[model samples]
Structure formats: structure tokens, C-alpha cells
Target: MTSSVLEAQKLGRKYGRRWALRDCTIEIPSGHVVGLVGPNGAGKTTLLKLASGQLEATEGAVTVLGDRPAATPARLARIGFVAQDTPVYSGLSIADHLRLGARLNPRWDAAMAQERIARLGLAPDQRAGKLSGGQRAQVALTLGLAKRPELLILDEPVAALDPLARREFMQGLMEATVEHEFSVVLSSHLVSDLERVCDFLVVLVDSRVQVAGETDKLLATHYRLTGPRRDTDRLPADQQVISASHTDRQSTFVVRTDSPIHDPAWTVTQLNLEDLVLAYMDKHTADRRAALEVQR
Candidate 1:
């Protein structure tokens, strides 16, 4: 088994004159449920597609399970991809979809699939088009899981469901992961969803990776400091400011540093996952505006 389930070195993709994803590099270790978080237009779909071999990268290289993604039939069999919106054929019944999966995948587990459907209380004769949004998503997930892939990539699978539905869907997914022991890369714009299920995180913004690491480590290294007004240039070299804001006589900053903070003038507090992700996103936005100002 490969230590890393997915690896990319400066991977990128473009269409016409616009680059959808650029200078993207990340390595997801095996046995993790990695959450890919970013706003809309962050190129999350493009990156996932590249990983699943649905689209080729215009530059750089990507490897899945120590081989090029989707390089062969056997290689493809080991990776499962569920695209955004949880698409299912409207014309096919639940049983028909399972039949299709069995025919298409060499490692299909019909009994497991049937068992999952039965547990979900879904009738085999029910048409996919007649199912609720959550039910359809479950059906799609069942198909992906039944393939028995080493790695499964899900693109915003629960984006369209209601709060209750989302929770239920995620609960099912987490349960399946524990039972199957497969690596997963799930993408979403909502932090709350990822916060509940992911151990690893990757934040993408402006078609680039803003931050990527284990969630606990990221939370530990990042701190929020509040102090009397002071210029960021005066901060210690080890402290990298991610985002900053100032009032008339006070300043607040989110900083990343491995060393302990001993400053007596500032009060430091730990940041949550949402705070850390937002700080990086804010820093990226500020930098882009600064670059635009320089051009003007």
C-alpha cells in the first residue's frame, strides 16, 4: 500500500485564457478523511476531477496510489469518484443502478450494496427520480462505496441537502469509512460539515492552496493576539501574520508560529478551525488587493 493516497507537484489546469487551478501542490496521506474547503470558484471541482482522471492537468504531475491517476483499468478500479450534486440516473430504479455498477466495476460487492440499501430502508424497485434529495445522495454514495476503492473522492456531496439530511448523510459516510478503512477526500464550501468529519484539511483560495495540514496541528500553531496598536513590521520574525485588523487604539492579529509566545503586551488565544481557515482566506484577499493597487 502507498503511504500517500494522492500526490501532486505544482499541478495546474487551464481553459482558454483563464487558469482554473494553478501552482497547486498537495500530498494526502493514507487513512485520512481530508476535507477540501474553499469558497465557490476556488477550483475544488477542477482539482478533484484531475485526481479522478476525468480531466488532465495542463501542467505539473499528479499520482494516485503511486501511479498516474486513471492510468489503467486496474488503476481506475482502485479510485472512486462521486461528482458534485450527487447525480443519479432519473430513469433507473435502485436495483437497476446496482446492476449497472456490478457490470462496470470488477470489484463490485453486490451483497454489501444490497445490504446498504436495505439498511437505508430503500426499496429496490423505487425509481431514483422519485427519491428525496437525501435518499438520492445516499444512493449515489452506496454506488461509490460498493466499488470498494482504496480512495474515494467526493465533491460537495451534501451541498444540496437540508440540515437534517446533511447530518444523516455525513453520519452514514463516517460509519462506512470506519467499516471499509478507505481514504477519502471530500470537498465542500461549508466549514461546519468538514469540522464534524475531517481529521485533515486543505484550504484553497484564488485557484491556489492557501493552507494544508492536519487539523489539530493547524489549530495548535495558529493564535489570535489582541494588543495596543502596533505595526505588523515590529512583530518578531518567527510570527507570520495571517490576518490583521486595527481599531483606533487596539489591534488584533491571527498569527502562525511554532514557538511559544512570551510577549507580555499581547494576550494570545487559540483559534478554532473556522477562525484559522478564514484568516488564511482574508490574507489571500488582502494580498490580491495590494497587488492590484501596485499595478494601478
Candidate 2:
């Protein structure tokens, strides 16, 4: 219903002395499958938890579907979260899980749940513990989808699955999204997976958002330029370098700029989604290293 599915402003979460997420501000617009990609400990999970109301922010604020996340029963019903490892009760049968979901969620669609389970060829009597990792993930995803939430958040749902299983899980998810017409925020380390499924992208690193935008726009604006070796200071100010490397005879830089590069000395090429995300991530790491060196 809102223009944005998830909105955060200076959002941060601290665990005693350590900050899991800091100064993360992003507005994920509605009707898009957003990919949240970053390396380990980049605060992707922390941000997802805050959005799903599993954890409170230590600073700033976050809103989901135009209201404070999970502020009330009604609001909670509108947002579904499938956490890492696709958690499920090993002792419970698939039917039991559906029953539990129905009992807890007022908007739960029992028929749809049953239908999905049958379509997946999973027996209602099958114990979650007996199911494969991929099957368990599917069961969890079914629960989330049956709730009929306006927004669904998945944190590395397929991280433990094999290649084929991971593809299957993602395919099923995309199909469900198309059918249900809900917004999604998915976090994963597999950039290639994200590239396949996500229309919008968010790159988080070192407890901060390095960049966030539509995938097409990000790829279009960011370019990889290679030319004769030169200091970054010599490049135009408009070309904000995200990451750079130099050899004795040549230099390469990833930069973000709206303007065209007409300089004859440099060769510019477009970057893929994975490259774009990595460029931002590499830039963050480089900046941190530079700061630490200065301190030393």
C-alpha cells in the first residue's frame, strides 16, 4: 500500500560495544525484489532483523509498509520473515507446521498452503526433520507465503542448499512473488543468485550501506575504466572512484558518474551487477584499510 516497502533513516543496532549495523539508511520502493548483498558481518542480517521487528534499533528508525515494523498484530500480519537456515521444528510434521501457522496468523490461507505443499510433492505427514534442506526451506517459504503478507523478508534462505536446490528454491520464490504480487527483501552472499532474482540492489559493508539503487541504474552509471597509469587525483572530480588498482604502465578504476566519459586516453566498459556490487564493497574495504594505516 505504501510507496516504499521498507524505509530506514540512520538505522543502527548495537550489541554492547559492537555495532552490527550503523547509519544504514535505505528506502526500498514497493513492487520490487530487492537484493541485500554484502560480505560476512556486513550487517545484512541485522538490518533484516530490524526490518522484521525481531530486534530493535539502537539509533534512528525503520518503517515497514508505512508503519513502525510489527507495531501491532495487524501490522505484524502484513510482514512475513523467513530467517536464515529456514528454521522449522524438526519434530513437527509438514501438516503440523501449516496448522501452527493457521493458528498464529489470522490471515493465513490454509487452502493455499495445502495446495502449495501438494504441488511441491511434499507429504503432509512428512516430518520436517526427515526432509532435505531444500524441502525444509520450501516448507518455511510456504508458511511465509501463505500468511499473504504485503512484504516478505528472507535472509539467506538457500545458503545451505546445493547448486540445484538453491536454483529450485529461488525459482519457486520468484514464481510465488509473481503470483502473490508482494514486495520482497532478500539478503544473500551469492551475488550471482541475487543478480538473477533481484531488480533492485543494496550493498552493505562494514556496518554501513555502501550503495543502493535499481540494478539497471547502478550498472549503467558505474563504469570500469582502464588507462595509462595515473593517480586518482588526476581524474575528473565528477567521476567518484569506487575502487582502483594500478600497475607500472596501466591503471583501472571503477567509478560512478552520470556524465559520459569522452576522454580518449581511457577505455570505459559497463559493469555487471556482481561487479558493481563488488566494486562498492571493495571500496569500503579499501577505505577502512586506508583509515587504519593513517592511525598506525
Candidate 3:
């Protein structure tokens, strides 16, 4: 069984009257790759920032390595973060960045950094500002990986890369995970990337945690069921409808349960990661509609 490396309780963030994130509770286990996902304006970045200690939560608490994320020097040293936009010193050369990381980070591994640079085929003297967008991202990743962190976090690390570069970056990440025992959490709007690299997923929509769990269990337990159309009065008491669509003679639904379903008239189909995400997004869409109707 995997033990949690990070835990949050009633986590929330607010700006004026707007709640950027609210009632967000999640447990992140160690030594596995996790994907953090949601649409634009969904607070994915905010959550990552809080987890990395860059932003403070408005309420509740978050702990890293069982210590508060803020000002825990030892804990901070054990975590690595590659923020969105792949931030780097514009005027610094690739070698300069590597040297700076080695000097500043207490646990930096020089040999590991050099090996990564060689693997990526990057020229050490090239100025970071002079490299292409994707190359800069690679440099940032190299810096992150060489720190020998117990937990690594990347916020939309591949959003700016071309298809080939993106694939290469993901490949490198996979190789690192297998070669070492460190855990990683990456944020991306691209579902395809998550499908390819992650064994665990945390889906956040509307600044709230919609689901967080093992990827296989989520895919295996959730199903879409279709049967004769009926109003709310006709659904089986045991069926937990996640989302629904209907016509006069037929109704389709996404439901969750651990019990085996054996209804003769209902056809059940398994959902892929993309389908599951879409179903949850649809649930939020319907909820918004209902709220607007109430206002009217």
C-alpha cells in the first residue's frame, strides 16, 4: 500500500468575493506519477502553487512530508517544482543555469545534471534566452530532476512544446520515474498526455475535487448504462447516477458502484479516461444550468 506524501484538509483559496478553490481535500501518495487536470479557469495551477508552497491557502491546511509546506526548509529541499511557462533566467546560458542550480540547491547532483544535458543533446553554452521554447523547458526539467527530490511537481510542463518535443519530454519523465523511486505530479489540460504517462489522476472541476484515486480502479469501477427512458422515479434505488441523457424510449447514464450489476434490460459499457473526464465535466455543466434556472 502506498503512503501519502502530501495531504490537504478543507483546502481553499479566495480572492475578494470569488473562491478560487474551496473545500478541496486530497491525499497524494508517494512514488507514483499523478496527473492534475481541469479546464481553463479551473484552479489547477492554484492547487499546484499551494502544494509547492508558492501560494498560501485561504483556509484549512496542507502538509508536505507531514510538515507544513511553508518554511519547512528540509521538506522544501526534498521537493522540486517546474512551474508553468518553464521559468528560466533569460540571459543565462544552459551551463550557467546548471551551475546556479548546483550552487543553490543543497542536494544538487552535478553528474546527474550533466548526464541529462548529454541525453537531451543540448549544447551547454547555448543561452537559455536563445534556445527555442521547447529547449528551455528541457533545461528547466533537467534542473528539477537533478535536485534529487523525493517529490517533483510540474505545472503544464509540456503545454508549449511541439508534438515531437512533447513526446520526448514525456518519455524522459517516464524513464526518470522507472530509474529512480521519486514521485511526480504534473498538471496539463491535454488529456492524451495524462492517459499516456499517469497511473493516478486527480480531476478538479470548478475549483473543487471531482475525483482522486488509482487510475485503473476509476476506469474499472465506472460504467455507462443504457435502458428504457424513465423519469427520476424509475431509476433503481441502488444505482448512483453520475450523469444522464435520455430520449422517450431510452436513457443512458454514467454510474459508480463496486457491486456487480446484472440487469437484463440495461447495457453497460466501460469508460475510457477521456470518456470519464467528459462525464464529470458534463455533471458540472448540468449543475450550472440548474443553478441558473433556480435564479430565474
Candidate 4:
């Protein structure tokens, strides 16, 4: 098997006349909890669906666990997906779901499923439709975990949960990760939630991948530089500017570089994950404005 859990090459998915996701290229390494962060309408869900084989790409290719997604029963079985709503069969009881999982998944862990339901204090006979939203989410997550997949993709799985429920769900996920050595790609608009769990980060904006890398490496390489007003062209070529703003007397820029910044004229500050994500997102917005202006 390939070392990468998921790989997308110039992947594009269009809806009607507009592309929901386009020119996306990313390779997610195995054994890391990856966070896919973006705003609403950012194609976060589209990309996840492509990876899980729920949607076909209009252009390019996407591979999950080193094989083309949904290539065969075995390939499809290797991935577990929990969508934004944490969909569950409303008519089925929690126990019925377990039985279905066992009947369908070759690698289903019946013991794990029973233990998780018991620990969560969910009644075996409780129909999914009767459960609270959070409870239903838990049941969906339990089913995903019990499938014993090599890779799991979650698309805003806790977006509708209460704060306490969200915390509990995340806690259970972390515990399961510790117990099972599997890869996860979790999509969320909430950066704070991702900060607590993911080691790898991918920031998407306007249906494009703005930046992607290990969280620690990204944090180390990105910085905010403040100094006297200067043209962006004057900055060192190696320092890639993510965003820039200027006043009459000063210019501030967010840049990514591995080289040391020894400029005595500038004051540099380290950026947290939120800062970095916003910087890239803002840059994309600015670029769009510039493009529109040029057209006019």
C-alpha cells in the first residue's frame, strides 16, 4: 500500500456551470489526524465526498488509501465516512444498526460496537429517529468506528451538536484514535475544534487549496512582518507573501519562509493556526477582487 492515505491530483468537481472544487491537489499522509478547514460554500463537503466516492470528480483524480476511490468492494470498505448531518437510519434501532454493520463490513468489530453503545448509555432498542441529535451523531460515529476502516473521513460531523455534546463526541473520537491506528480527515469550519485534535492542516478557500502541511511546520514557517511601508516586490524572493496591507507609513505582511528573517527594519511575530488560515483566506479574497477589477 502507498504511504499516503489520500491523494488528489488537479481534482475538480463542478455543479451546473460553476465548479464546487477545482484544481485541488493534496496528499494526506497516513496515521495523522488531518483537519480540512474552510468557510461555508468553500467546497469542503464536495472534496470529502470525492474522497469517499460519494461523488464523482468532473476532472482529474482522487485516490483513497492508495487506490482509486470505490474501485471495488474491498477498496470501498477500507474507508468509513460520516457526513455533515451524521446520517443514520431513522427506522432502525441501535442494535439493528450493529447487526447491519456486522452483516456488511468484512472487518466489522461487533465487540467494539457493543462496548461503545454501552459506554455511551444508549439503549439497544432505541430507534435512531427517537434519539436526540447528539445521540444520533454518536450512533453514526459508533458505526463508522466499528467498521474498522483504515481511513475515516468526517465532514463537519459535530456542526449541529451542543457544546457539551461536541466535546463528548470529540473525546470519544480521540480515544478511538488512540486505540485504533487509522488515518482521519476531518472537515470543519471551526478552527478551534481542529486545534484540539489535528496534527495536519489543510486550508481551503473559494474551492481551492490555499495551503496544506503539518500544523507544527506551518506554524514555524509562517510569520507576520511589520515595518515601514514597502512595495511587495522589495521583499526577499524566498519569502512567499500570503497577504499584505499598507498604510501611508507602514506595511504589514503575512509571509511563509524557512529562511531566517534578519531584517532589522521589520518586527516579526509568530502566527497561530487561526491567524494563518485567515491570512490565506483573505489573500484569496483580495486576488478575486483584483481579477474582477482588471476585467472591468
Candidate 5:
């Protein structure tokens, strides 16, 4: 059995009275690519911050490689984070940034960093601010990769790049993960990027984790069922209704269950990664509506 590199137990962070992440629990094993998916204000950033040890959990606990996230500097060094904006000092040149990272980080690999920069055709003396958006993102990624961290977390790393650049950036990540043994968790709004590179997924909505699991396992467990309307009471307790819609003669439902269905009456269809996430988001929205009505 593979060991988990990171684990969160009822982890959470609150700002004043609002919870940024509430009861978010997940175990991420090593050597897997995890795709973090969520819409804006879903606390994706907050979760990443907590996991990266950049922010302390307000309640519960989080462990990085069997140690408290903040307890071990060595463990913290084992993780690399590319934040939402992909921060790079504008005043510093590309080479200056690399040099600083090499000097500051104990695990920085100079040869690997240099090779990546050369491959990208980035000049050492070029100011980061002078580079194009795509180039700047590439520089940030190069720095993160060269750190040789056991866990790499990227927040919207490709959001600034164009389609071609995004593809290239993901390819770079793939190569890094293949050549190096490490676990990666990257957040992106682009489902296509996640589909191409990640085998694991975590979906967050409204400051709560809606789903988290192996990508294939999730896809296998969830199904789109369409058939004539029937009493929901007939559905087994194990089958969790994620979202449901009904017309006079037809009913469609997205459900998650462990049971297998081979019946002909219900047409079972596969769901793509994007549709799967949206189903959870829609369910959350509906639940919120019901809560507001109750308060009224």
C-alpha cells in the first residue's frame, strides 16, 4: 500500500465568522497528479495555502509527510508552491530570481533550472517584468520544478498562458513528474488541462469539499441516469442523489453509488470531468437555496 504524503483531518480556516475551508479532509498519496477544481471563491486558494504551509489551519489538523505542516522546516522544504498570481519580483531579472532561489533553498538543483531556462529560450539577464505573460509563467514553473520538492502545489499556473502556452506548460509538468518522483496538486479552472495530466481530483465548492478521490474511481462511481419519473423512495439508500431533474414523462439524475446497474430501463451515461464537477456545484447551489428558504 502506498503511503500518504499529505493528510488533512477535519481541516479548516476561518476569517472572522466566514469559513474559507470547512471540515476539509483528504489524504493525498505520493507520486500522483491531483487536479484541484473549483469556481471562483470556492476556497481553492485557501486550501492550497493551508496545504503548502503558507497559512495555519484555524481548526483541526494537517500533516505533511507525517509531520505538522508548520513544525518541520525540512518538511516545508519538501513542498513547493506556485501561488495564484505566480509571484515573481518585477525588479529582479530571471537569472537573479534563479540565483536567489538556489541560494535560499537547500534542495535547489541549479543544473536542472539552467537547463529548463535554456530550453525555454529565456535569457538570464532578462527582467521578469519585461517577459511576456507566458514566459513569466514558464519562469515561475521552472523555479518550482527545480526545487525538487516531494509535493508541488500550483494554483492556476496556466491561467495566464494562451492555449499553446498552456499545453507547453502542462507538458513541462508531465516531464518533471516523470523524471522526478513527487506528488503534485494543481488547481485550474480549465477542465481540459486537468483531464490531460491528472489521475486524481478534488472538487471544492462554497468553501467545502464536494468531492475528492481517484479520478477514475470517481468517474466509475458516478453515473448519469435518465428514465421515466418514479418515486425517489425506490432508490436505494446507498445511492446518493447528486442532482435530479424531472419532466412529465422523463427524469434525469446524476447519482453516486457503489452498486452496479445493468438494467435497460435506466440509460446510464458517462460523465466528463467538467460535468462531474458542475453536478456537485449545482447540488451545493440547490442546498443553499433550501437553507435560505428554511431561514425565511
Candidate 6:
């Protein structure tokens, strides 16, 4: 089994009266590509910032590589972060960024950085402000990779890129992971992109972690059951219902269980990653509705 590269316990972050993230607990295993999936305003950026030590948690704790985040120089050196905007010095050239990276990081991979820039066809002397969106993103990614951290955290890194650039970036990221044997935690609401590059998955909704586990295991265990309208209480306790919908004549439930389902009264169908994620999101929506009803 893979050891956890990043762990959070009851983690939370608040902005004034609003909670950006709350009761968020997750474990990202070492040496695997993990995907953080959530809609806008889902606290995905907040969680990533916490891991990168850019933002302090309002409560609970977060650890990266077995040490508290931002606790020591060594701890900080072990993580690489590329923010959602992929910030770069607009006035600086690509070579200038490499020079700055070498000065700041003890383990900077100068050769690797140079090779990647060459491969991307980015001119070493060309200013960052002059590059296209995709080119700029590539430069930012190169800088992150060259730092040679044990864990790399990316926040919606491809959201602004064209489809082709996104594919190339993902391909490069995968290759780098294989070559360096490092772990990654990438945030994106686009299930299609995550599906291609990540083996582990974490789904967050409404500032809380809905579910997190290995992608294959999650897909294999979750199933949809449909049949005559019936109360959920009638199903075996072993079938943990994730989401449910009902009509006068029919009922449907998304469930997770380790035991084999043999009931003839229901039709069981498997869920793709997108389907599974949406079910959890729907469950969260239902929970909010129920809370509102209780308040009335």
C-alpha cells in the first residue's frame, strides 16, 4: 500500500463569517496522480493553498510528507505549487525565471528546465508577457517541475488553456511523474481531464469532502439500483445509499457496498466517474435542502 504524502484532519479555513472550507479530511497517497474534483466555490483552491502552506487553517491540522505544513524550511522545500492563474514575471524572460529558480531552490533541476523549455519551443530570451496563454502555462509548469518537490499541487492549471494545450500539459506532467517518481494532487472540475491522468480521486462539495479513494475501487464499488418505488429503509443495511430519487411508480438509488448484490427486485447498473461524482454532488444538495426545511 502507498503511504500518504499529504493528510488533513478536520481541516477548516474561514473568511470572516463564511467558511471557505470546513471539516475537510483527506489523504493523498505518495507516488500516485491524485485528482481533486469540485465545482466552483467548492473550496478546492482553499484546500490546495493549505497544503502548499500559503494559507493557514482556521482549525484542525494538515501535514505534508509527514510534517506540519510551513513548519520548517525542509518541509517547505518538499512541495511545489502552481496556482490557478499560473503566475509568472511578465517582464522576465524564460531564462531569467530559470536563473531565479536555481538561486531559490537547492534541488533545482537546471538541465531539466532547459530541456523542457527547448522542447516546448519557448525562446529562452523571449519575455513572458509576449507568450500565448498556453505557452505561459507551460513555462509556469516547467518552473514547478524543475523545483523537484516530492509532492506537486496544481489548482485548475488547465482551465484557461485550449484543449490541445491541456492534453500536452497533462502528457508532460505524466511523463515527469514517471521519470521523477513524485506524487501529484491536481484540482479540476473537469472530470474528463482527471479521468485521463489520475488514478486516485477526491470529491469535494460545499466546503466538505464528500468522498475520497482510489479511482478504480470507487468505480467498482458504487452502483445504481432501479426498480419499483420503495422506501430506502427497505434495502439491506449493507448497501450504503449515496443518493436516492423517487417517483410514484419507480425509485432509483446510487449505492456503495463491498458485498455482492443479488436481489432480483432491483436492476443494478455501474456508474462512470462522472456519474459517481454527480451523485455525490446531488446528495450534498439534498442535505442542504433538508437542513433548510429543518430551520423552517
In order of appearance, the predictions have TM-scores of 0.95, 0.95, 0.93, 0.93, 0.92, 0.94
In candidate 5, the residue pairs with backbone N, CA or C atoms under 3 Å apart (3 or more residues apart, or in different chains) clash, namely none
For 174-237, candidate 1 gives per-residue lDDT tens digits of 9999998899999999898899899999999977788989999999999999999999989999
- Model 1 misplacement above 4 A: none
The residue-by-residue lDDT of candidate 2 on 1-296, one tens digit each, is 53998989999999999999899888889999999999999899999999999999999999888888865788889999999999999999999999999999999999999999999999999899999999999999999999999999999998999988889889999999988899999999879888889989988887677898988889889999999999999999999999999999999999999999999999989999888888888888899899999999
Question: Where's the lowest-lDDT run of ten residues in candidate 3?
Answer: 230-239
Report the CA-based lDDT of candidate 4 relative to the real structure. Answer: 0.92
RMSD of 6: 1.6
Root-mean-square deviation of Cα positions for candidate 4 versus the true structure, in angstroms: 1.8
lDDT of 4 by residue, 6-75 (tens): 8899999999999999988888899999999999999899999999999999999998887889757787
Model 6 TM-score on a 0 to 1 scale: 0.94
- Whole-model lDDT, candidate 6? 0.92
Better of 3 and 5 by TM-score: 3
Model 3 score (lDDT): 0.86
Clashing pairs in 2: none
RMSD of each: 1.5, 1.6, 1.9, 1.8, 2.0, 1.6
When summed lDDT is taken over every stretch of 10 residues in candidate 1, the lowest stretch is 64-73
lDDT of 3 by residue, 189-254 (tens): 888878989999888887777888888998988989888886655667776777999998999999
Candidate 4 clashes: the total is 0
The candidate that achieves the highest TM-score relative to the unseen native structure? 1
Output the lDDT of residue 222, model 4.
96
Q: What is the lDDT of every predicted structure here?
A: 0.93, 0.92, 0.86, 0.92, 0.87, 0.92
